[model samples]
Target: MTKPISGFSKLTKEEKIDWVTANFTQNAAQSKKILQTYWNQNDSVQQLHDEFIENTITNLYVPQGIAPNFLINETLYAIPMAIEESSVIAAASKAAKFWLKRGGFKAKILGTEKVGQVHFIFKGDAKKLESFFTYLKPVLLAESASLTKSMEKRGGGITDIVLKNKTDELANYFQLHATFETKDAMGANFINSCLEQFATTLKKEATRYDAFSRQEKDVEIVMSILSNYVPNCTVRAEVSCPVEDLKLSAELTPQQTAEKIIQAIKIAQIEPYRAVTHNKGIMNGIDAVVLATGNDFRAVEAGVHAYACRNGRYSSLTHAQIENGIFKFWIELPLALGTVGGLTNLHPLVKLNLEMLQRPSAQELMQIVAVAGLAQNFAAVSSLVTTGIQKGHMKMHLLNILNQLGANENEKATLTEYFKTNPVTHHGVEIQLSSIRK
Candidate 1:
């Protein structure tokens, strides 16, 4: 049973914590201690973390790790990953190392165009609307010059604008579809600024258009924003080697292993349920790099998932094929990333992560992220075909179980060695932990 309190947001930080603990926590003092324990000791750094978002209590920490030996496009890299999931880093590293001797990964940028839209309703003649749009196009672009000037100077700016009539979808529904080339940056802010300006200009011009009646001229702007579904902002990463080159282990012959891997991927490609999880594995790699480099993982995830279902079926993002004694695995994803804006220059760890990768441009980062995803999928599917995904996943999950059961260092060491040969399960670990404590 909880009671509501007014002015919760306006309370002082200490007062807010007190109210939360008093109303919710069984042990208020311990709860307070736990929250404060995670705060940075450095005052300035703590302050910086607090301002990152609203209603900050304490920092929620995710392990920042590196998956080394990622050889992409004739260059070697150690990719930074920030995630809470067990086995993700280990799996990525294993995959990277496995491919290091097999010519590594090759990645290329397919496109860098981003999209934005200005939606409005025009209860007017279609012919008149078209005529008005023709005259308004250059004016809209010209009005946005101040906003796009800096981006244009950096070799990135608005690429094209087109008026789309969607009146059939909904009466008077229309959109000003715009495309952009945002080099070395995610360009959300730039695109959005330009779009708002377009919206304003459209409204102002419609008010003065000589050909429009009063009702027709009153164009109601629904919204102006950049779209996260950036199908045109895409990259591809692939790994190919001779069928005989996949000498991963002696348990399965290379040809058999290749067949199994391809079949596993094929099942995912045709099945929606499996494809969702399969694509999730790919995102585990992509998102880690995106977050480490101070880019928007949410935007990347949404766009990538949308792209996965672009063929009318939600299939696997990673594809596989075998032809002429050659085996190939690849993935193409729409990753809208940035290296010069947002958190790249703000957060300390983000700066370090970017510097560790030798300061890649947006395109370079895209290639790197795509390679990470491809490697991750290869490792996951390879394991699934051979030893089963759970074996390695459970092993990586052992530490988390141990921490949860409050195992001491000595107990953890013994259990760690024992589980190397035995399967790790929550119940099994708990029983062993209880026996050890007794």
Candidate 2:
């Protein structure tokens, strides 16, 4: 049995699956959906069409397991995530269990506002394009000033909007940076709505032009896309653990473990090339939750990479430190995520996760996400510093094999002994299982 810690409940291996199956709510709700909007069986756009001859996308219903032991922003939260990776759920829960000996994760956010961009493409003529935007900017702003949604009225709206010119190999293009204020939403749908409205107005004004009449003078829209350069909202989480508790399972001095883990992370952060894989490990935790909740995982993925290289120095999404024998950690990913929009509220698994977390506010969910990231990092680092990651994970792999082989209790014991003694082989397992059945 695992040692007990405050604000956390320890589960045996069996209970973990039960918990996931419960809160992920596989039994209570219908998970499978053949919809045009979301596709999981078919992972991406190219794969869906060329490979699979299916028009409808498959909405995946992966398990949303709660990572126990987190207290962020004065609220205790059991983070619920959906991911299929072997170690992520286990590693995060292990770290949370250890951290429970302390006060758990404390976190804060800068604000809940987000920013989006809309690109406007013009013709190849440089001087002609310049003259068009010069006239269009005033028309674009003045005509759409009152068009500001509830966001602008409620102390936050399109505070800053600007246009930029680009000369790429394809053609000359202009982009409208619509820096809008999204109070709590990640603002993808809302911003896109505003962009559609603004774009329609701009195109309408262009039709009545008494200006440049050449065929190339028209605002040829290459792509009026929404930009992922998020607003100034930053999320931070801090978790501390008792040294005495960590010393039990890990067998290393708490300070030594912390130092070793932090050093490995520093290496991952310092190098740009290594930082790619490093941040991937972080996203192993983030993407799971985002996917589970039916939020835009792609946007979160974009924001993370964008945030990593923001300062020209490539760094890990999370930072860890040992201060006064306390393991302090913080992650500042651009969690430009929304709770109210997209499939977040539609999917059953996501709804269950949200309910299990006690239905936190938008900002609170971001903090919880950061906490999961912190726990996941700590989990991975602790194992790497002490016993190496494969030690626990490999055992789980063996158990999975056993389940796949359909070994009964007595046969499982016999197979375990055989596995421990003999060289491993998939063919051998099939033959042996066949013989046992016969």
On residues 207-308, what C-alpha lDDT tens digit does candidate 1 reach at each position?
999999999889999999999999999999999999997776679999999998999999999999999999899889888888889999999999999999
Error of 1 at 75 (Å): 1.2
- Worst ten-residue run, lDDT, model 2? 28-37
TM-score of 2: 0.73
Candidate with maximal lDDT: 1
Question: Residue 253 error for model 1, in Å?
Answer: 1.3
Q: Per-residue lDDT for 182-258 in model 2, tens only?
A: 65556776677767766876677666666656554466554455677564766887776544445634467766666
Candidate 2 at 334: error in angstroms? Answer: 0.8
| Candidate 1 overall lDDT versus native | 0.92
